[model samples]
Target: MSAPPPADSPRLDLLRFLERVQLQDLQRTRDWIAAEEKHAVLEAARRPAPPPPEWLIEYGIGTGRPAARVHAGSCWDTRRR
Candidate 1:
């Protein structure tokens, strides 16, 4: 009887090495892209500074304390003491 074909034949596995090399290269490129995205995000975060105290998003969006200025003996009327 004729022997079956060999599984390790060059024609059958010709692309194995090339596929492995391509996969490694693809993984390296993916890692580089991820690192680049992280670096870009960090750079963007650092470039912008916090808003100033006077920088209001909305002038009358929420309730604010009364405009009455502080006066002497005013704390006695308050229940916190």
Candidate 2:
């Protein structure tokens, strides 16, 4: 019987070409993702942190009484105490 044709057929060549094109597209997507991640990190780093919250010093009901308690400016119990 006759042997089969060689492996280097036109179909195989077309498949190889398609594979290369897909791989290039995948690599480009990955590169875009990496660049966006880097940009996010830089933007976060450049942003300034918020200032510290205000502090409230509650004093005892006396002429020279010490501080009753220390609370933040936005504490709910500050008005009650």
Error of 1 at 3 (Å): 15
What pairs collide in candidate 1? none
How many residue pairs clash in all the candidates, one count each? 0, 0
Superposed Cα deviation of residue 39, candidate 1 (Å): 0.4
Residue 30, model 2, lDDT: 100
Residue 71 of model 1, lDDT score:
29
Residue-level lDDT for 78 in candidate 1: 29
**Which portions of model 1 miss their true places by more than 4 Å?**
1-6, 49-81
Specify the poorest-scoring 10-residue window by lDDT in model 1: 53-62
- Residue pairs with colliding backbones in model 2 are none
lDDT of candidate 2 over 1-81, digit per residue (tens): 977656898987898899999999999999999999999999999999977569878889878979999998778777754
What's each prediction's TM-score? 0.50, 0.56
Kindly list the per-residue Cα lDDT of model 1 for residues 1-81, writing each as its tens digit. Answer: 988658997865877788988999999999999999999999999897855343222223237844333324423332221
